[model samples]
Target: MSTYSSNQEQFMYQTIIKWITDDRWMMDILRNVRSLSLPDSWVCAGFVRSKIWDQLHQIEPRTPLTDIDVVYYDATDLDKKTEKVWEQQLSRIQPELPWSVKNEARMHIVNGIAPYDSTVDAISYFPETATALGVRLDEQDQLILVAPCGLTDVFEMNIRVNPHFLQGRGDMETYTQRIQQKNWQHTWDRLTVVDS
Candidate 1:
């Protein structure tokens, strides 16, 4: 089974409305993509967190959403020039939104990179691909939500999200061990332990 359900978006909408006011921001962030002719989706894994909350957080009330995860699946069969055009266009667009960049706690993707960062160059630092229910917009402007599609969302585009950066060393065995040893909520405890 997938991590999300396309039909369950309403559940996501209702659950996070108190904090995110999601649709409004989605429409705004996507305005430029719509102008340049790209298709995208404002998906929430936390939406899945909605039903699973009682078992995890011990309450079903609103959780402070971390970020607005948007994945744009463009269908333009992009050549290098076409990709560059869209990338530059999007770079000019991100700042217009109110999302925070501190550790990418505001808005980001799971597959693609920041518009100014190239896949060939940035991939060394992050990976890019389509996300679950992987779908993108066609040149005609339609939302195709499916799985194993063209590209995953840009979860790596998040600012300073290198899961291992704080560790002064290049070895991530400790970090990987941390993730393996803990739950998602406390995944960053090692960093916070330093701050405390």
Candidate 2:
């Protein structure tokens, strides 16, 4: 259950949207992804999380993203090659940007879980609640945000394991390794990491 009320979630959603809108670079990335027109696609994970964390920390300049993660659901065409093709397309649009494209429909095979229902479903299963976020631009160029686990954790700078990870859908060792490797607290000093 979410600790935040619906109003709080809505407020945070609006806050995030406003932040992204103010960021020309982020808006451009969203625009580039929208051009692909992939079914149920969004730039997710650290791409969104890092932005919020950086904002919350009041970092002077934006933290450079290691890569822009683009995820879409296309059960009809689960070809992994399609992801690479999309990456190539995005690269042509912004060659300097590091882009990673993935078809969530086929990611289940890699994650050792039953097929995900949609891109949002796949996001909910991400290792950490803070990372289970996504955003995209709609036809009207309006920003849309999705956080299946809600916004409380991210807003509070809490890095807790997702419920799916706790339910045996994912393993602890992998989660632990990710937490250790990410060491997000080093970047966002206010963050509190909860492995268990």
Candidate 3:
């Protein structure tokens, strides 16, 4: 069962799409990722989450991202070096941007989980519901959102642990440490951090 109604989901989806569409820098970043032509790729995590939070906070001059996380699924080649090469490519294109590219195919080994079915599946296992969100630009340049946990928590500015992290599949200590390290509440004062 969905935590939110379909109507609410649609509204959030449209709102997010509109926000990204209106931001030229975000669109250019999407274009650069698209140029790589990686299969089932997206700019995920803080890239999309921070934008919504910033807009909700009504902050100006957008919060600078620590890194631009570009994720993709390619079961054929799981080489870590290739991910670095892609990151270097992105850096060459936009020297100022902090790019971090990862092949989700090999990430399972690092996360100590079974191989993910796809990039979206990998996102679903992210620590927080809000951070699990991903965005990509389609061939038509239309925004595509992959929200395995839905967008209610993000739109509502609520920070909740992803069930995947709560389950035995993940470690609570790690999740707790991440929340503390991120200190997201300090930045987005309107946020509500939920405990499970």
* TM-score leader: 3
TM-score of 2: 0.95
Question: Considering only N, C-alpha and C atoms within 3 Å, which residue pairs clash in candidate 2?
Answer: none
Candidates' TM-scores? 0.32, 0.95, 0.95
Q: CA lDDT of each candidate?
A: 0.33, 0.90, 0.90
Q: Give the per-residue lDDT digits (tens) of candidate 2, residues 68-147.
A: 99999999998888999999999999999999999999998987778889999889888899999999999998998898
Residue 195: error of model 3 in Å?
1.0
Q: Name the weakest run of 10 consecutive residues (lDDT summed) in model 1.
A: 150-159
Q: 19, model 1: CA deviation in Å? A: 6.3
Q: Rank the models by TM-score, top first.
A: 3, 2, 1
In angstroms, the error of model 2 at 24 is 0.8
Write model 3 residue lDDT over 130-157, tens digit each, in one string. Answer: 9988999999999988888889899899
